[model samples]
Target: MANQAAPVRSFLQAAAKTEEAPLPLRVVQIEGLAILKIIKHCKECSPDPVTGQLLGLDVGSVLEVTNCFPFPTRDEDEELEAEGANYQLEMMRCLREVNVDNNTVGWYQSTFLWSYQTEDLIETFMNYQENIRRCVCIIYDPSKSNQGVLALKALKLSDSFMELYRNNNFTGEKLREKNFTWVDIFEEIPIKVSNSPLISCVMTQLETDSPVNQCDYDRLQLSSTPYLERNLEFLVGCMDALSKEQQELQFHYRILARQQAQQQAWLQKRRAENMARKAAGEEPLPEEDPSNPIFKQNPEPSRLNSFLITNQIANHCNQINGAVGQNFSRLYLTKALHEN
Candidate 1:
C-alpha cells in the first residue's frame, strides 16, 4: 500500500523537479530514465507464415519501456543487492495501492508462482513464474519479415517469487507465516495464465499462423538455428556502438526499394497536377516556370541524388557498406544480389 496514488504522484512530482533531461552525451540516472532491452533474434522473424518480404522484426526492436522491471533472473543479482529490499517492498506497495487485499494477495502465488513480502524486501521477491501465470494479455508486432525473432515461453520455474528471493536464506515456514511467500503480499488479481480459462483463450488465438503461433509450432517442428550460426553476435556488438546517423542509414538501406517506389509516386503526382489543369481548360503548368527555372522541368532524380537525399534526410544515413550497399547502392544492387 506504500506507493499509493497520492504518495506516488507526490514522489513523481518531487522526482521530476530535481531530474534533468540528459544531453546528447551524458550518463542517465535510474530514478528518471527507463530502459527496455529486448532479446529477439531467430529465423522465424517474418510477418508472413510462408513467404513475404524478408522484413521480420529483428532481435533489436525494443517493445515497450514500462516502469516495471523485466522479470529478474540470476544475472541481475548484483542489481537486486544494490537496490536493496526496497525493491520488493515497492512492488508490493504498488499492488496494494490498487486495493488488492492481503487474502487475495496470498492466492497470487498459487496463480502466479512468486513470493511477495512488504517488510523483508531484499530476500522477498515476486516469482516471475507467478506473474506469467497471471498475465492477461500478450502482444507482438506483425510487420517484421523473418530476418530474426525472439521466442516467448511459458514459465517453468518450480519455486514461487518469494522463495527464490534468497536474501538471507530463512526457512520456508518462517517465510509463509511472515507473509514473505508469493501469497502474503497481494491478491491474485483475478488473472491466471495457467488457469483453464486462459488456456482456451490462448488456444483460440494460437490456432492461426500468427507469429506467436508459429513460434510455438516452430519450436516443436523445426530444429532451431542458434544465434551462433548467424552473424548476430557481431550485429549486436555493432548495434551497441551505432550512432544515430548510422542507425538511420541502416533503416534507409532496408527500405531502399520502397523509397524508389515512393519517388515514382511523387513524379506521378506532379505530372497529374499538370494534366489536371490542362483538362480543366486552364493553362497547363510548365514543368518548370520560366521565372523559376529551378522548379521548371526538374530532371528525375538519379540513384546518386537519392543517396545524397537520404543522407540529408536522416542523420544516421552515412554511407553504408556490405549488404546494405548491395541493396541501396547507386549501381545495380538487385542484379548483384541475383548474381551472388
Candidate 2:
C-alpha cells in the first residue's frame, strides 16, 4: 500500500527512538516554537498547501510537538513525491546529529479554508500508523487565520473509524452496523501551546508595553462579507460533489433493481416452461442457473467518498456559523457603545 506518504517509512524507522504511545491519544501539547514555525511556513506558502514532519515525544496521552520543518516543494510532481521521502530522512539524520528532537511524532500540513477532510489525508494517516502507534496531523489553515483566529488543530482518525477504514468497507450496511458517521471520521484532539517559563516571562514583559495590540483591530473589523462569500463558495462546491456521489449511488441501485427484475422474469419463464413440459410428459430444465448473469451479486458502491464530502460540507457550515456568530457579537457591542 504505497500511498502519498509511502516515502516516510525510512524516516519514521530512523526516528523511532521512544516508546510507542498507548491508544486513544488525548491531547497534543505543541511547543510555542513549533507553532511559530508552522505558522511561518504556512504563511510563507500562502495559497499553496505545504506539508512537514512533526518531531517530539508522545508521552502517555499527551503528544508534545517540539519542532518541525517544511517539505521541499518541486515543480515536477513526481520528482517531489519520489524525493520527498529522502529529504525527510536526510533532515532527520541532520537533526539527530545536532541533538535535536528528531523523533517522528507525526506530521503537519496547511489547508485551504479549513477544508482538510479528504481521502488523501486518511491515506497519509494510515501510512504514519504503519510506523508509529499513534500520531496526529496538525492542520493549520492560513485562509481561516485571516479572520483573526489561530486556525491550528490536532486531528487523528478515530479508532473505530480507522478499524472500519482498514477493512476498506464503507458500505452503508457496515457503517450502520458500526454506528459510524461522517462526523466520526476524524477525532480532533485539543491543542495546548506550551511555552517555557523563560519564554512566558518574556512574553509577559513584551505584553506590558501595550494595553491592546494593533493586531486586535483585525478581529474587530466588521468586513466579513468576503469571508462569508468564500465560505458559501466552498459550501456550494461540496454540495455539488455530494450530489454527484448521490447520483453514483442511485445508478448502482438502478442497475441492481434491473438485475433483480431480470432474475425474477427468468424464474417465471422457467417455471412456465417446466409446467408446459410436465403437461407434455417431457423432462423439465432446471430452474436455477448459476451461470446466469442476473444471479451475480451487484456490490454496492463505496460510501467513503460520499461520507468525506459530507464531512467537508459540515466544515464549511461550521465556519460560516462561526463567522456569523462573531458578526452578531460585534454588532451588539457596537450598538451598546453607541447607546452609552
TM-score of each: 0.19, 0.89
Give lDDT for model 1. Answer: 0.32
- Per-residue alpha-carbon lDDT of model 2 for 106-143, expressed as tens digits? 99999998888888999999999999888999999998
The lDDT of each candidate is 0.32, 0.90
Cα lDDT tens digits, model 1, 225-336, are 3322233343343345334435655565556656556566666776899798889888866443345423334222122222222322231222122224433442364456
Clashing pairs in 2: none
Angstrom error of the Cα, residue 84, model 1: value is 3.7
- Whole-model lDDT, model 2: 0.90
How many clashes (backbone N, Cα, C below 3 Å) per candidate?
Answer: 36, 0
